[model samples]
Target: MILPFFVYGTLRPGERNHDLFLRGRTLGEEPGRLRGVTLYEGPGYPYAVEEPDGAVSGELVTALPEAYPGLLTALDRLEEYVPGDPRNLYERVVKEVVRDADRAVVRAWVYVAAPAVAARLRARGTPVGGGEWRERR
Candidate 1:
């Protein structure tokens, strides 16, 4: 069975990795919001953290499990995803993102920056909004 993932960052719209990573093979795309999370812009990508009244807007895409590994690698390059390394530009985690008010329980990856990284960007005067821009909706 294929997995459904919700993407809210570079893979959304005009982001750098949009065309390269999500150009074709868009099985399903929808403008949906994930509740109880705060989205933060770290530098190049955005990260979502658990927040009581916050959420992140993005697209829910369904992909084949076999093709997921390569896709993840591509996303890693664009977001600089690194495991066990907080210095990495972006990090991925399995989360539940809502789409069309329907819950799809799947292992979807999201790009997130460390708190320090987000703080630096915020200090520099860039803030990631809770509402995602260029989402599938």
Candidate 2:
């Protein structure tokens, strides 16, 4: 079975790296929100925080199984999503993201960052929102 992942960070569509990752191969993307997580931005990509009362809002992007491996490597090269090291920010893993307005669930891939890294990024005081990634007219 395909695993569920939440793409609250840069992996969401229309971001800086969207064309490199999810442009042609993307199955679909839908507006999704997950509670207990918030956005944290750094000099580059955004991070996700698992706060008790926080929530993360982004898209649910489904990709083909064959394309996922390459996508992972690309993300790793971009955001440096690593396997080990607790302090390492942006760990790519399967996460449950809401589909169809919380009524249905689907398998997706998400990159979650460590809280410490997120905290540091927050301290830097950068704007946090998916809109910032978009090109303004």
Candidate 3:
């Protein structure tokens, strides 16, 4: 089955990790936006946290059915998301993402900062205004 991902950080197309993990594994990609989330600068990457009136910019990637298992595995490792792990750095969840081209909303998997981590980060993290990770410092 084909799976869709909403990627805002390194896994977005043209980003370093995208070339390494998603370039040939994806069936297609397009700009997407997730509402009620904000982007924050992490040590070397970025993280998304919930916010009342925010919209995070990203890419919606359709995983190739044959390559999806491996691709998803690699992504989980990269994001430090272990299924059922309470200490996971990120948690993969289904969220509604709006396609940039047609503004169509679709459910997609997205890695988001865990609740406690998000609260701490929100307390002091550098917010990327407009929720575009690539455009921030």
lDDT of each: 0.64, 0.63, 0.89
Clashing pairs in 1: 31-137
Per-residue lDDT for 34 in model 1? 73
Query: Can you give the TM-score per candidate against the true fold?
Result: 0.72, 0.73, 0.95
Pairs with steric clashes in candidate 2: 4-107, 4-108, 5-108, 5-109, 36-54, 37-54, 37-55
The lDDT, on a scale of 0 to 1, for candidate 1 is 0.64
Candidate 3, superposed: residue stretches over 4 Å from native: none
Candidate 1 lDDT for residue 27: 61
lDDT of 3 by residue, 1-137 (tens): 34599999988877889899887888899999999888998988999998878889999999889889998899999998998898987899999999999989999999999988899888988899889998986
lDDT of 2 by residue, 1-137 (tens): 45534665556676666786778666667887665565666556666665565566778776667776676667666766667867566666666666757657654666766667766765674545532233212
Model 1, residue 35: C-alpha shift (Å): 1.8
**Order of the predicted models by TM-score, top scorer first:** 3, 2, 1
Candidate 1 per-residue lDDT, tens place, 1-137, comes to 23556777777767776677776656666766677666765455566655568777888776545667777667677666678776875556666666665664445556655566655654563435546754423
Better of 1 and 2 by TM-score: 2
